[model samples]
Target: MRYAVALAVAMAGLQAMPAQGAGQRETGLEETLAQRCDAAAASPFDRDRPSGVPGVPSHEIDPAIAIPACMAAVRAAPEVPRLWYQLARADLAARRFDEFRDMAARAEALGHAGGAHALGQSHEAGHHGARDLAAARRLYEKAADAGFAPAMVDLGVMLEDGTGGTADVAAANAWYLKAAEAGEVAAMNLLGDNLVAGNGIGRDAALGARWYRRAADKGDGFAMASLGLLLELGNGVPRNMKEANAWYRKSAVAGNRRGMRLLALNLETGNGLERDPRGAVSWYKRAIEAGDVMSMRLISFSYFNGTGVPKDPQEGLYWLRKAAEAGDPAAMVTLGLRYTAGSNVPLDFERGLGWLRKAAEQGEPRAEAALAVLGDAPPGRSACRSVLGDYHALDARYGALPARFSGTLPAFRAVCAGFPGLKEDDVRRCHLLNPDGAGDFVRRVRKQCR
Candidate 1:
């Protein structure tokens, strides 16, 4: 899963300002235009536009016309900070970092915080330059002090992470509260997260859900995703899978990867939506493209079982190992078992145990069982004792062998052939599609087969 920012650090973006320009003019000509646009056309600056850029959202603007129009407007009003800021926004969106910096600096020097905020975002993300968290925090502070709500959210993140200075949880929550009070949707989401975790605020899931709903109403994808989680888990709210799926759909539509993942998983299982393997795969692919590494492992499992795609063990192992190496703990556990059992490759106990160690270090409780096979203790025994309930669930689900797990059927029969009261198939389906039940069968071998 992506970091919340606990997760991803993206705070908020700059909203368009109402001011157009101060009405000044400059000379220069058609040679200055970058990207695709005609110099003769006027910039599309509409004062009445309530949201987005002057007249249209960035996505609606024709790239062939945007840069040229903004350049013409800047030339027509050289000293206008608003015009410079607009061009800077356009430049930054177009990935023209040098031009963006120059224009944004000019607008910032003229006392416009929008340009400064954009520049600070670039610094925070280290776009087209070295990462400089200190510089980013300072720039964000400048913009926030100038009454920029988005900057307040960004500053709070830096403070929370100690990016520019000492980690100050209370101060971070304060900034988030300030921006939320000012009606910044992203700030509301951050503040809600803090409250839910009691990081710097009181732990209150009800209050957190309220804040999430408020931001969701304002069309914030992160907030929508958070609200969906609360609704789905009944955390300070009644469990309503249908409502949760609706919110997940909204969040996914708004480009939230976490939402896309959950919606995809739900679609696959018919949890709240109709089971549509193809649709699930589509959403999974989208989330994967958006940098959701965990999706790789899930998609790989689908491939292995031919649940949502063609059964291709080679391709499945490829993706599974890739994700595991990328530090996905569940993937690591699966890969560990694969190596240990020589499922698709030669058996390599040492290497398999090494994979388990990596997953264990990452606090994957599941990895502890496989680690125990190597006689590694303290950590293993403690991990097992801590997750006794999980082990119970594992045993209850896979204590007996099912016909579907044909690959491990021989081993299961040999070990549990005469064992009484172990017959079960109702919960055996889990063994068919997932690696989670591997431990239950393995424990039987270590005990009876020996």
Candidate 2:
């Protein structure tokens, strides 16, 4: 009996030794799979690794390769938070927002701060779902508390803007300072903006310039453009047109639309460099291609005056319409006025009013006032209506002035008296309704009607 028991024990020990060896091999394979996923999907902005070491940009990651590798890694080590986070990043790169959200939630549950921040961003941006600002703010707060620099910066923006809750400028500044101290470039830019604007903080222009320079030195294009602005205007730094233009060129090369536009403006006006209308037009076109609506307007003006290109009113009109179509309220207002005045296009009251109504709906005070004036005029009074619309368009191009007192005063009153139901006092007041007075003017009109 003793021999039989010993033989059974020896067999069990031999079997356990092989099982241990198999377990070690499986562990090594799982690690290799996880590493493959990490290589494919890790973010350049990830704070998990050592500071200042950039990994792959999310856009550069090939989803086809990343997704399969990450899936295998996640399957191999389901309990590893880092693997789950990497898988989430892969899904996000593929624009599989729903899957990314789920995977990010899993990684966040497993205590990955990057996963929490990414999840918060998804909620904030309303990716593949409704925006849940409260949920986003909560997630950002959690990750920020965990010492995540990106989360700290995002949370600061939310608090300052009151996106998910009441505005807390002090708290927002605190978070920005924290992230900035931790070497977050975006936070540095925000800090610079706040200091320059003195928004809920004491003015510190010199300090703001320093903050902008710090981030600009780190290859942040937005900061480079901002610092350039300060230098150009001599706001916080000594006026240095050469340095400012150099920074603007650097920022433009780095793909900043504002930088491109600014560089174009400088070339056109000879502000910081010799006037080069052709170069200005080229830069403006580049900015337009980069999705800058304002550049569209500027380029349209260039085409209208033959500044660099040949005089082409039709091309100018086309660009104006493009800007208006892209939802630029200023462009809509300009196009609406031009249509009313028959400046570029044939006189079309309906089309003009339609454009003005769109701009008014977006809270453009100029559009609202123009609409009010035209609305009171009878359809039969086309000549009177044209004069009113033309004067307003001129005001929009230049700046607003008192309607009863401007160059159009004689015609303005004559038209006011011609309208059957229109009150001259109300018409004049409409012209006075600048952006700051728009709300009060609306309230008074509403009260009068009541």
Best by lDDT: 2
Q: What are the RMSDs of all candidates, in order?
A: 10.8, 11.7
Model 2, span 1-450: residue lDDT tens: 432354355435434543446779678767666677778887655666434435566667877777777777787789888778787888888788988899999989999988998899889989866899999999999999998888999999999999998899889988998999888898999999999999777889899999999999998889998999899888889999999999999999999888998889789768779999899999989999899887887787678768889989899899989989999777788788778767678978779889999999999876877777676666555555554554454344323113423544343444444543335564555555333233554343333222
Error of 2 at 449 (Å): 35
Clashes, model 2: 0
lDDT of 1 by residue, 1-450 (tens): 211221012112111223333331112222232112222221233221123333344445443445555665565456656567667766665667787788778878887786677678777777767888888899989988877777889999989999977888899899898889878787899999988888987899888999999999988888998999888778888999999999999999999888888888778767778888888889989998988877777777677767688988888888778788888877777777666656655666567778878988998755765565433323323222222222322322222223334433333332223332223441253345236355564454344333
Query: TM-score of predicted model 2?
Result: 0.75
- What is candidate 1's CA lDDT for residue 40? 23
How well does model 2 score by local distance difference test?
0.77
Worst 10 residues of 1 by lDDT: 6-15
Off by over 4 Å in 2: 1-23, 44-47, 50-54, 126-129, 349-450
Worst 10 residues of 2 by lDDT: 396-405
TM-score of each candidate structure, all chains considered together: 0.71, 0.75
lDDT of each: 0.66, 0.77
